[model samples]
Every structure is written in C-alpha cells, then in structure tokens.
Target: MPTVWVLGAGQLGAMLKQAAYPLALNVEPVEPDSEHLPNIAADDIVTVEREQWPDTPVTRHLSSQAGFINADIFGRIADRFHQKSMLDDLAISTAPWRVVNTDSTAQEMHAELGAHVLLKRREGGYDGKGQHWLHKDDGGAIPADWLGTGIAEQKIPFDEELSLVGARDKDGNKVFYPLTLNLHVNGILMASISPLSRVAHLQSQAEAMLGKIMDSTGYVGVMAMECFRVGDALMVNELAPRVHNSGHWTQAGACVSQFEMHLRAVSGLPLKAPDVRGQSVMINVIGVERNIGWLKIPATQCYWYGKDVRPGRKLGHINLNHPQKSVVQTALSELHTLLPQNYDQVFAWVKQELERA
Candidate 1:
C-alpha cells in the first residue's frame, strides 16, 4: 500500500480521501494543528491546500518520507503579478496587468491599466473574499490586514471566463481535463459547463502555461488556470495550484475525475485522459438550505459537503447531466424554476419579473 500524508483536513482533502479509496491509494490527512501523524513517506506527503501550510510549525514535522506538494509556491504562483511575470518570461499573452503596493502605487498602476482594478492579497483568498474593486474616485478602503501581502491588477472586460484543470505526474508527464465554461454570481462561481466547444485550442494554451508554472515551482500534481475571453483572445486571469471549483462537473461527467487525477499525479501513477461523454452543467448550492426543498431536478446528482451551512456558504453542489446538449439547457431552465422566489419583492425586480414571467 502506498501511503501518502495530505495536509489540511478540509473539504478538498476529504474529497481526495474519498476518491483515493477506490484507487487503493492510502491517504492520511493531518490537520494543521494535529499532534500525531501516521507513518507516511516524506516524498509521499501532499497538500490539498498548500497556502495554509507554510509558516506553520507543522511543516518541520513533514518527515523525509514525505515531500510537500502544491508547495509553498502560493506566493510565487497564485498572485496575478507573479503569474503575469511568469507569462512574460514565457512569452504568453495575458490581460495587461500591474501590481500596486500602496495608494501612490495604485495611482501609477491605474494610469497604466485603468480606473477600475482587481485587488487581492498576494497569498490566500478564495470564495470571493479578500478581493475588492477599485474605482476612479474611491478613498483607499482596502484592508491592510489581508492574509499576507496584497496585489492589484487591471480587470479585463471580457466576454466570458474559462477554466482548465490538469495534472503533472512525478515524471513530469501531464494530462488535462476538458476545458470548462464558468458562470459567476456576485463574484462566486454559480455554474460550470464542461468540455467547452474550444477545448483543443484552450487545452494547448493551458498545457503550455501549466508546464511553465510547474517548472518554475518544481511542482507536481494538479493545477488549474482561469482565463478570460475577449473577442478571439484568451487572457489568463488567475491560477489555482490545485484541483478547482470549476472542474467539479467531472465527477459524473467524465471517466477520470480531477480528485483521482491529483491522486495519480502526487502518488506517481499513470494519468488518465478525460473521457467526456454527455454535456454537464454543475450548479453550486450557495446561501441555500435543504429545508428550502432544494429541488432535485431529473438527470441531476447532488454532492453535499459535510460542512456547516452559513450565509453565502457553499454547502454542496449538484451536477445536472444529459446525453445531448439540448437536455443541458433544459435542465438549467428547470432548475431555475425550482429555486425559491422572494416575496419581499413587491416593490422590487421580482414584481417586474412576475409581470414578465
């Protein structure tokens, strides 16, 4: 049995645990504050969330048998400026971007890019938090206490955002999952459409990009890239050094799920090419409750995370599938009808929609 120690017992780790079981990969998750770790190889140690492990004393305990992965490259690979720098070094075209360190720097950056910008910390920020939009005349309200260092970049006006998920094995062999078209609601991901129409073109770009990123970090395992489409150009938006939210549609939509791919990559196994059959639309369950009669649409399968539900929380997600592209649109339309409508809308947009629907 090949035993691997995974840091972070969070949702990603838990899901990876589930996926690895069927593959006979022994995965042990050691919480950041855990006092004990089962006997695991040092080179075998991987991280479900790499950014959280750095600066923690537990890293000292990562025995020689274990090797940290999704490594401490968060600061090096996750930031927009760093990513752009890497892109420039590799001669890739991305949205024109600049990094701002202070309010004065913001002005110079604004002049270089635009009035509006996307501001985020250099380190950790996810689920639509730790990021703020900067307008032309706003006072500097950016919190100084963001997780670690902070960065800012020009927000590109693009038609849509695309995300790609892929993995590199111990031997540097890489395999990519199908490209996915993403939809976001209020900065949080709401839906994902997989095996996007332009998979080949996007796949080539993503593989080259990931290869460069992984080479820079000496990283092994899953990495995802978010890209923005403006006219005919694909501009890289951001990179996640792990399996991503947009790729979750693969669970029931493909022969090789991303979690299993991460497992294969980190544990030195053969990478399986994604075999996408039917069209899939993955809808996120956010700010939603089971008591709301969360509609179980036909051709849909639910994946509920064992997490405490909260306002704006991602409790779980559902992947609604159908054989042809026609059913996909129908499934989405059906799900839209099933969601609850607010009655507090007598003077609101719902009242207008009520007359239209």
Candidate 2:
C-alpha cells in the first residue's frame, strides 16, 4: 500500500495520522518548511491539509509528483477569483461579486455590488483575517494593498449558515454525510451540528450542488462546501478542497469519519455513505484553558490539539452524540456548566437551536 504524505502538519494532519493508524496504513504529516524531504516513492500519495503552500523546493518537488491527488484543482480553488468564476460558469448560486483591480474605485464597487460590500484577499486568509467591510455610509475605501488582489462581494443577508462535507474517489464514487448547521463567532467557527431532522429537506439539494462541483473538476478526496441559507435556497459561500472543521462531528457521530474517508478515497478503497447514529454537536475549544472536566458529560469526546494556548486560537474541539435529541441536549447542558462563563451565550444559542431542531 502507498504511504499517504500530508502537507501542512496542523490539527487536521494530526487527526489524519490518528485515523490512519487503525487502518494499518502509513501516514506522515510533514511540516511545510522543513528542510528534510520524505522519499517520494513511486506509489506514495501526496495531499494537502490546507489549500495553499509557500513556494519552496520541497513543495515544488512533492506537488510535482504523479501521486499528488487533485494537484490541478487546488490552485483554481485557492484563488477566490478563479473559484467564484468556476461557480459562475457552472451556474451555481453565489453572492454577486467582481474582481477589484488596482485602479478600481469604491464608488463603482458599491454601485455594482451594493452599498455594503466585503473585500477578501484572493489567497490566504482565515478566521476573519484579511477581510475588510466597506459600508456605503462610511464612504468605505479599499486598502491600497487589497486593491488588485481582492474580490468584492455583496454582503449577503443570510438566514443561517450550513455546510456539506463529502468525498469522491478516483473512480468518481461519492459519499456524503448529512448537511451540518454551523455558527461563526466573529468569523471563527464556534459550533456545528449534524443530521438535523429539521433541515432534512435540504440534503438532496446540497448533495446535487456539491456533486456537480466534484464531477466538473474531477476532484478526488474530501471536499467541503460552505453556504448561506436564505429561505429555502442556498448560496455558495466558499469551498474547502480538504476536510473541514464543520465535519469534526463525524469523528464521533459517524461510522466512517471524514479522515478515514479521505484516506479511503486517496488510497483507492471502496466508498460508501457513512452511518450517522444520531444527533451530534461539535463545539470548538478556542482560546480556552484545557479542562478534563469536559469529559464528564455523557456521550462526549474531546480532542486536544496539543498546542500552546492563545487568544482566538483553536486549541481543540469536543463532540457529543446520542440517539435521542434530549440526551444530546442534556449533555450539552452539562457541558455548559463545565465550560467557562464565556460560553454562556454560545450554549444559549446552541440550546435554542436544539429546541428548534
């Protein structure tokens, strides 16, 4: 069997390594800037945890290999300009948007998109970084650096946010978990819940949209699509060409976790839909001190990334699952008490969502 070499050894890579152990498959998480290079044996597979990589000899050599999966797709998807263009070419729904050229004026952007516009760097930004909001009332000006490198989009008035995490194998076989409902706190993912009976009606629509993308691009392995729900329709927000944080619930909630599914896809293993046993919720442990008490709640599992704690950093995540929604709800209540006081509003929001579910 070919060893899977993952670029960018962050939490996602760590989890991939963990998921590989049970399958008796060799998986390596290599640091992006390491001077050392793994032997790229003819059959060894290459994949990325994050979308982009620095231009280095190591990256160039690895990405140039025959075994690198979805190599051609990454660049197109990584650049927001190309990504939005592809979506438009496919006639997929997304926010109205246009490229911001160096000579472009804020007046034209506002006139074209809307009074409220969002400018995002074409490449490299996460957790609300590298973004600027231009409000018509404020006479919003585009940062000089952002000009020619950003894409301006109409500020969407979304009712809720949702995501679909799915995988496609080399033969184009695809499998998807149920759509997940997500909440972002200040542009960072805070919580995710999956297999909601309330939103069940949207599953097929979500699958069809994502399937079209993978099919068109011949994309293999795990891909995630984030969207905004306006009434019964979904507008594409962004796409991740790797496993996503929203799918973290699958680790404890599904029979086949996303990590395993990615491995299976890239390794040429069989594909099948994962069995989701019950309602599941994933709470991101951000900027908070570690607490062993988090495990005290029933049906709860915690994963710590072993990173030094810092404000606004994702240190770990906790997942809860149960056959009955009430059981999951009770566990969440217990978890709330065990968490810091800062979690009060988060819990309140999640619990309220549970009642609605």
lDDT of 1: 0.69
What are the runs in model 1 whose C-alpha is more than 4 Å off?
Answer: 63-65, 70-75, 79-81, 102-105, 138-148, 198-201, 291-296, 342-357
Candidate 1 lDDT, 35-144, residue by residue in tens: 76455554455566555455444555653233666555656675656767887787766767655554435556567768887777665677777787777688454455
**What C-alpha lDDT, on a 0 to 100 scale, does residue 109 get in candidate 1?**
54
Give the per-residue lDDT digits (tens) of candidate 2, residues 1-357: 789999889999999999998777899988879899779899999998999999987798789899999999999999999999999999999999999999998999999998999999999888888889999999967889988999999999999999999999988899999999999988999999888788889998999999999999999999999999999999999999999999999999999999999999998988888999898999999999999998787899999999999999999999999989899999998889877887787888889888888
Q: How close is candidate 1 to the true structure, as a TM-score?
A: 0.84
lDDT of 1 at 8: 73
Per-model TM against the reference:
0.84, 0.99
Kindly report which residue pairs in candidate 2 clash with one another.
Answer: none
